[model samples]
Target: MNIRLHAGTLLFAVASFLMPTVLHADVFSPTMSYSYADGVALSPDVSYQFNEGIGLSPVVSYQYYEWPGDGVLQLSSSPRVSYLFYSYLGPTPALPTAFSTTSLPPTNMVARPRVPSGTQFLVYTSGAFASGVPLDTNKMTIVLTHGWMSSSDAWPKDMANVLTSQGFGATANIVAWDWRVNANLSAGLEISAARTPSEGEALGGELLYLLGANYNKPIHFMGHSLGTMVNCRAADFIHGDAKNSPGKIPGSTLKLNPQNTHMTMFDEAGAVGVANALSLVTYMLFLPTSGDTGDLINNFWTKVIPDHSAWIDNYISEVGRLHHEAANVLLWRRFAVPVISDISSGLHAYSYDWYSNTVAAPLISAIGHRFSFERNTLSPLPPSGTYFLQSADLIDSPFVVTPLDAATANSLSSGRALVYPTLQAYNGLNVAGNAYLNGLNAAGNVYLDGIQHAGDFLYDVTEWVLSDFNGQSAYVGTGTAGSTPAYMIPAGSAPLQFFWDLPFTLQKSTASPLALNGANGPIIHPADAGPDITNNTAVYVWLPVIVPSNTVGMSFEFKIVGAGTNEYMTMGVSNENYFTMESKFLDDGVWMSSGVIEISKYAGKQTQLFFSMNGDSGLPDGKLSVRGIQFLTVAPPTLNISVNGNQAVLSWPVITTGWQLEQTDALSSSNQWTDVTNAPGVLDYENTVTNVLNSGARFYRLKK
Candidate 1:
């Protein structure tokens, strides 16, 4: 997400926004342009502060240019000024140092800390699916998979560093897969899990060939969105080889138990298979939602209007309704011609033409799509610019029968595309997959590609990341082909271990009632709380989305079940905004209801709930639990320390790492610190330098 500022001079601080401050423009003015696609928009090109992590652009206005008689025409425009969170993690960039609880801005934490040259590799997992760095014999590999429309760059840098850091004596080897050419968005994108099983058998065969006995060692697999599917499919392939042809995988394949693996499902959003593999997974679900492909199409229509003018609106309403009913001949015609015709669309067009030409193409390409049609055709469509144009035109055009209005076009063009809630569902599925593999026990059912395709196999890639690669038991069940197996399917079980408690089942639609009678006091809903729930016990609230610093539509409401007079409970966020519930302690068991509260917003961000108690002990007894906690992304902490005179100073951002410090008296020469004594309170340099000669300029920075 990008934010624009009209003023030329601006100072972005950590407390203000979640994402790193990326100053895209050096000089700001009134007129600016933004390019909106899929779920996000790009601001006008400027001297961006990539290292700084904060983005500064001008607030742009949008309007459609229509022909004199044509009341409505398609147009593209930019978004107004708003604070945005740039990452699925914290808004700020990842820090280069070790983990900490300190709250520092991401922009100021980009200092590249010195890494030991003799760092070994044991903690990280290496990648074999997509192209990556050559594996070293001595280093442990950390394999990472990119999600739909995502790349290696998207992998949290901090995670990579953590994975690579030595725990005991193991050195880490980080491997990033660049599968763009293999899984092009619009092209014949291969579903990691192929239905026939033999379709990806070649890749599978090669994987076993490379792994051989090495498969015994645990290989950490990290993926997002579609990448989760890829990881699961790969595991299935390996599983099939072990079951069907043991010798094909080398060593004792079944002996490699998938349960012994250690997986960490962090910020995943994908399929139900993740939940199914609960027994063998360890998941740290960040933010999750639920959904499918057909739901995706409907969501876009519901949220984004293709046509705004009366004519287009009427036509679209009619056509779209017919299309839904499968009653429109034109809809079928478009589908058949584009999907079935061999003469018109080329091979690449048949597969990928949807990307280059349309505004929607870019959007879809930037994110990701599953079960695309281009891969199945015998004579695939060749690359054609028109196909892209046609696809984009289709997006801009209403399904019914109307031309687009200026506002409608502007909506499409505005680069500030907010992520649809349904997208979170998709993300949730992926997260579930990682959790399932990691033994994190997710909540959801398993669905492949959001489509019920036969033969799409699901594998547990986390097993590879968390298992002991040397000599480990493979199969959980005894061989049943020749004799009775030790383990049998449980009654009424739906793919045990593969599916765990998904959010669909974990979250309750009906909330628990507040205590009408208790010492904690009365509770009420935000609506009944009058102006605030600060004085009562309240819980269970719904927030649509996290807002930017300037967006107007930020609001929150909840119910408070306790009394407002004496002891009370309130809901709110903490310093970092990790959800927290505050309440007053009570001695006697008497409770009063304070009702619910609704808050507009501060700094344009939604107002969180809080409960305050009066007639009670001043201290809280940690009895409150807030369900549905939301957190904005935070930048990583990178501290650069240098000695000036007798004082130590530090500075860092997202990009530029190196820095120079000046001495108190003679600022002439400077020395570099390759190692750092990173302890509590102080950031000490790795090297020791005495103040022999006075220097002119002395600075320390993170090496890029």
Candidate 2:
């Protein structure tokens, strides 16, 4: 017989194996709220009722010194409010006597309670009053919600505190919602899960009120685990309420459930709520951790629960594992040391501490998944869009967890498919001697090479996103060949004369030609020849030459740079038959005369001369100027042939340059050709060679 193990039993097995440290006992208590005076010895600057419909009591505003001691204390202000309401989304154990009798059928719906239930909200902002404060409406307003077994004072409070210390609290309002009473873990998972939507709706009502008050402010919602579901439900409710409203709310572009909010979900519990919430938010950032078992429980729940089974199943099949580790992936930004050991719940709890401690400046080190954002902090920010970041080691760094096997690397490198099947997939690591691989070809998705974790990526992403929100132009790269196209040298207006004083018509070219008359000829600047030169541009110049057959060598004279400057210029010669064979550079500012270059390989071929100027390394003023260019060709020695008896003798005037004697049966283009094997000896300037004429008719030529 096959026995199906339930979610609770599986969790029990997992817990038995885990033996996690008891951080805090699961506490179940009636909902309660304490004022600033009750919790701490602080006097309130102002007190007023907030969210009257939810029976939200009087909220007090206070300005507290940021740092603990007298090192350097700055008074920062954020209004804090605590309010409660009855949650209607939870399961009702019984129907009221007024609605049900012994014979009447029972109904799932129930009448609203006369008194508000214990759903609570705590708003933390840098503003002066509860509703209005000194904040930039154009900036983001962050709302943090906690998960099961945790109060708003847990991670949410910590996040708010960190954000405040990070200076985000000065310009942005940060709020934390507390639903600890309903989230009491001792009440059973099912009961607490049932209450999530109701508490979320209450939170949504408060958000709607905030939106109505500060209509233009953009809002971002961040939640961990169960709180992610709450954020989604709240966002949905807010969208629905705004859409169904009679009149348009000022400062808000809301048109009946408009998606204007940004939402980030951490290791979420339920898929249905998250999927639904996705529809109500404009942008979504999902972070799932590796080796988390939260998705297993969620997957098991889908099979056992009848309600929303299809939705849950779809979520499980599509985004299950991603939902479990979303928060874990973000911890790298908050923690200095890599989280290498902890599993499951222990791993989950570390996210809170990391986020809290992240208020201080991150430890900049190359030891972990940290990426250098120093370059990104420049004036122009990178474009706002999705970017993929891959880690070198997933087991330790954990940015993306795709196994980089040979097949995976090939697929990524070939761009045939994404390396990983999940969203966690990124371009493969650029191993030495291997081609760089990036999976997402979408224009918006950029692959960040070498960056490993979500925290570091997000830290950079946060700055980039903020810059985009502030309407700044994006920065890509400068001085690269891809960014700067090659510049061709144009033909001269007058026919140019070679070193032999033979005039040749100039060919049309792409390089820019200068009109400046120099001591020897027209002087040209590579920067001015091509398109406008930026700070770091590279330019190229091409010159075509028709060299007469039997030429053995070439010589040229040129000036590299202007006097007393460190500019650079390089010249190379190549023919149609061969690649660039001769390239030479002159580093000094003075002119160089009579530079000899071998052209024996292209002795009988037409050639094109190439000139390149690299501005990045050439000069501090970004100019590569050249003048006094002259070219000369060296003629080959005369060859004489004769026959004596059964032997063929060949003789040529020898020179210091090297040359090879070749022979062919016929001069036809398709005839077989070979190099003459008979050795030649040079006596003074005359060389002689003799070969036995044992074969058919033969033709000979001297090649250099």
* Candidate 1 deviation (Cα RMSD): 33.6
Note the Cα lDDT for every prediction shown. Answer: 0.24, 0.34
Model 2: per-residue lDDT, tens digit, 1-704? 21111111011000000111111112111223322121233223333221212222334222111112212112222224311111111111111111101121111111111111323555576431132333345555677777666776566765676666667765666777776665653312333444555566566676666456446555666666567666766665565532222223555543223324555544444432211111101001111111212222221111111111001100110122232111112222221211111122233344444334323444332111121111112123211121222243434443232223444233223111101112111111101111011111222111222211100000010000000111121111111111111111111111111111111111112344432223423222222112322333233334344443433334333333332222333345542111111111123333333222334455445555544333334222322333322222233556789999999989875432466788988878688768888888643224678888976888888865
- Which runs in model 2 stand beyond 4 Å of their true positions? 1-119, 125-139, 241-260, 271-320, 323-345, 352-704
Q: Which stretches of candidate 1 lie over 4 Å from their true place?
A: 1-141, 156-158, 165-169, 187-207, 241-255, 266-704
Native-structure RMSD, model 2: 38.3
lDDT of 1 by residue, 1-704 (tens): 21111111001111211111122223322333532222223335532322122233455322111111111112222243332111111121211111111122222111111111211111233421223223444433344444333445444233354333323114434554434333332211111111112212233344444445355444444443334444433444444422233433565543223421222221122211111111001111211111211111110101111111000000010011111111111111122111111112321012122221221232233111111111111122221110111122334432222222445333333221112111211221111111212111112112111111011111111111011111221112111111111122222211112111101000111233333213322232211121212332222222122232322111121222333323333323211121111121122222211111111133224332222222233322222222212222212325446668765545432111122223233234664344333322211111223333234544443332
